[model samples]
Target: MKRILGLSLLAVLTLASCKKNEAAETSTATTTTEQKDPFADDRVVKQSDLVSEAKNHAETTLALSEPDFNFGKIKKGDVVEHVYEVTNTGKNPLIISAVKPGCGCTAPDYTKDPIMPGQKGQITLKFDSTNFDGIVYKSAEVYANVAQVPIEIRFSADIQP
Candidate 1:
């Protein structure tokens, strides 16, 4: 036929010149990866530097208006009592200092002073459970100032073999 229409028009001009050299190498690799952002303005994060880092973290935070304290049940050789209430909501002055008891049948008392700022305090936990048995759970460990975070208090009971 005219040499097969000149080899089918040279195979459609070699697939349209390889699709225009693969679309100019995919538009020059998407314009050089959108013009490389070297650190892109150091990753902008400034709301006045997060309000001066929340005013230097509210001047060395010392919060604890409520961590948790619940003593709901009591029976076995009953003597249980609980007070637990505290506040100093950070801005300084809540020096709880100490209050520990995880054993020894659990007993603790608090407030020796130094709770100013928004002030409020009280921490008393006394559980005797008569040498424990069965569901008796308890824990108390409050040490503060700049809040190191460890003031959990819980209690449960069910001892009556």
Candidate 2:
């Protein structure tokens, strides 16, 4: 009867040890498997050949014809357009790389060619008043090689039904 009791205790200890080993194996498997990010892209981009190490960093100045304009009143759904001149006021050539509109309702078009010193370029701003009412003000950013900070163009309108 004593022998039978001792064997029962040993069986319980063996089962518990097996369970601990199984748990450890499961934890190690999970750690070894690496998780991938769902939002990461595999695409890569290289620098363009047009980029050079010896490119000029000479600073310059820009003279905007109309830094700001005010349209007293405009009808709803009306499209307004304006042209502003940009003159290079410094020694180096002026390169207008891009014009970023401050709002989605505004669109911009500018001269792509570089302007020599004392020469000028044009920037056209088109504004749509479809979903606006009352006093609406908009602006755009002019990106050029002249200055580190881009200059701003501002315009306002009072929308009427």
Candidate 3:
């Protein structure tokens, strides 16, 4: 009976040691199998690139007052005003601190106040295509708190001279 008891204790210790070794191996395996960052570009992006990215990020949040705007036909030397109604669909309040046109020929005006969640705003685009003719493509770039992707609200005006 004594010998049998000693053998039983040894068997229990062996089983416990095996379980501990298995737990350690499982932990090691899990740590080693952790997913690595695939796109780990450590090199710092240039200031210009950062600025460009930030500009793009702002653009994305400036949900256009309208998706597609078309000034079908306008005579030369005509100034037209088109309003784009937009809503803040992002997590943060949409701020249209500034709206810069691509060129002086086109002018863009947006709401100065910050648009809260589910709130609406407007961006009016005025195109003075006096001497300009053909298919006029205009863009209104809104500067504000935007998503990771940059947003550019664009419209087109076709002027017939």
Candidate 4:
């Protein structure tokens, strides 16, 4: 009976030692993982920083006469048009690079020539609400060589089906 008790005590000691080793290994692994950073070499740039940089490097500044337009109420299959004015409010000339419509239903026309400092330009947006019903919202993006290059003009209308 004494030999049996000794063997049982030895077994218990072995199991307890194994559990301690396992705990030690788990703690080491967790510490190693916590010490490493996934993005250690990479830096994240903020949107406000990018905007500030763009503004700082921009030669010209663009000011929109109207940023939003309301068509009020319109019937289906009606064509609506609006001219949005852009002014160069900086020391340098403003050059419009492109005008992109949000969808195929919108037609955009803009001044091809560069507007000198203190001059004005225009963007003509024509929206056809043939297939659109209910409340319709559309946007046009203007790309220019200015501080606010990609400017969005939003227009909305309550469509009568």
lDDT comparing candidate 3 with the true structure: 0.65
Q: Which tens-of-lDDT digit does each residue in 1-161 have in candidate 4?
A: 99999999999999999999999977754332221112122243333443443445447888888999999999999999999999989888777765656666787788888799889999988888999999988886666766554578999999997
Cα deviation in Å at residue 28, candidate 2? 41
Angstrom error of the Cα, residue 62, model 4: value is: 1.2
lDDT of 4: 0.74
The global C-alpha lDDT for each of the candidates, from Candidate 1 onward, is 0.59, 0.72, 0.65, 0.74
Worst 10 residues of 3 by lDDT: 33-42
Candidate 2 deviates by what RMSD? Answer: 18.6
Q: Which tens-of-lDDT digit does each residue in 1-161 have in candidate 3?
A: 99999999999999999999999977754332121112222233333343353454333344565656899899999988788887888767676655545556666676777788788998887778897888988775554656442246677878897
Model 1, stretches more than 4 Å misplaced?
Answer: 1-76, 82-100, 107-116, 132-140, 146-161
Question: What is the C-alpha lDDT profile of model 2 across 80-134, one tens digit per residue?
Answer: 9899999999898887765656556787888888788999999988888999999
Off by more than 4 A, model 4: 1-58
Candidate 4, TM-score vs. the true structure?
Answer: 0.63
Q: Model 1 misses residue 98 by how many Å?
A: 10
Q: Which 10-residue span in candidate 1 carries the lowest summed lDDT?
A: 33-42
Give per-model TM-scores.
Answer: 0.25, 0.64, 0.58, 0.63
Root-mean-square deviation of candidate 1: 23.0
- After superposition on all C-alphas, the RMSD of every candidate to the true structure, in Å, is 23.0, 18.6, 21.2, 18.3
Q: Once model 3 is optimally superposed onto the true structure by TM-score, how far is the C-alpha of residue 105 displaced, in angstroms?
A: 0.8
Score candidate 2 by lDDT. 0.72
User: Candidates sorted by lDDT, descending order?
Assistant: 4, 2, 3, 1
